[model samples]
Target: DLNQHIDNEKCTKIRKQIRLKRTKIKKYKKQINDYSQRKHKYEVQKSILKDRNSYSKTDHDATFMRMKEDHMKNGQLKPGYNLQIATNSQFVLFYNVYQNPTDTRTMIPFLNTIQETYGHLPEYIVADAGYGSEANYMAIIDNFNRTPLITYGMFIKDKTKKYKSDIFNTQNW
Candidate 1:
């Protein structure tokens, strides 16, 4: 009777060991699945970063830019290209697509394109305040041999200020 009792105790211990092994297997399988998912996500991100101007999954060449039209009132980024054009008398003389989102950086490349196509630069470049920068101003003067009539970012604000005293007015002359 004592031998039979010992045999039963050993059988119960073996069953508990098997149950613990099964639970461990399930936990390991779940961890492996999670690791695979994380690895796949990293691979996709790496592929997107391989392209310089890519901001969208559908269009790899498009860049994220802030548009003037914001219906939501929040500045949302949209994937698009900068379209630069040189016009004369309301007619489009030359047009170029730039990958850059800012007008400040697009000036030199657009001027270079115009020179490459027409073999000469325009006499004057009249652009908005968005294209105004020290580098852009020098590029127009040095490379294109033209003057940029571009307004600085604070041109309008500076003109509207009424000084309390004429001592601050440099334009009084």
Candidate 2:
């Protein structure tokens, strides 16, 4: 009877440990799989964000930008693409989508896309002040035989009375 009591109480401690380990493995099996899935998702996101400052989580190609349509008053930036579209007399001419927020950097690429897609550029490349820059102007002058009627960023300020009165102002000349 004493030998039977020993076998029941303390003779198989290793077997007890084995049973506990098996229970733990069964309980945490789903947790280990969840952790593995999360790690894979993180790796995918890192690859998608390579060589970019920021990319939208929902739309990997879109960048964070301030949209005019934000319903909130906080002026919060959201995922968006800069669309450069040209129109004349209410007719669409050319359009391009850019990840950059500023229009200045999109001008040359937009022009190139226009030429590539249409096989010809308009005589006058007209754009707003935002698309105006010395680099853009030089590209238009050197690469294409087109005229850039784009105004610079200071177009409004240059037209002011204070600007016109300045002797150093080139517009005064």
Best-performing candidate as measured by TM-score:
1
| Structural similarity to truth (TM-score) of each candidate | 0.67, 0.65
Tell me how candidate 2 scores on lDDT: 0.85
lDDT for each candidate structure: 0.83, 0.85
Q: Write the per-residue lDDT of candidate 2 for residues 104-172, one digit (tens) a residue.
A: 988888888888988989899888899989999999999998999999999899778988899996768
Q: Give model 1's TM-score versus the native structure.
A: 0.67
Clashing pairs in 1: none
Where is model 2 more than 4 Å wrong at Cα?
1-46, 70-73, 164-173
Off by over 4 Å in 1: 1-54, 162-173
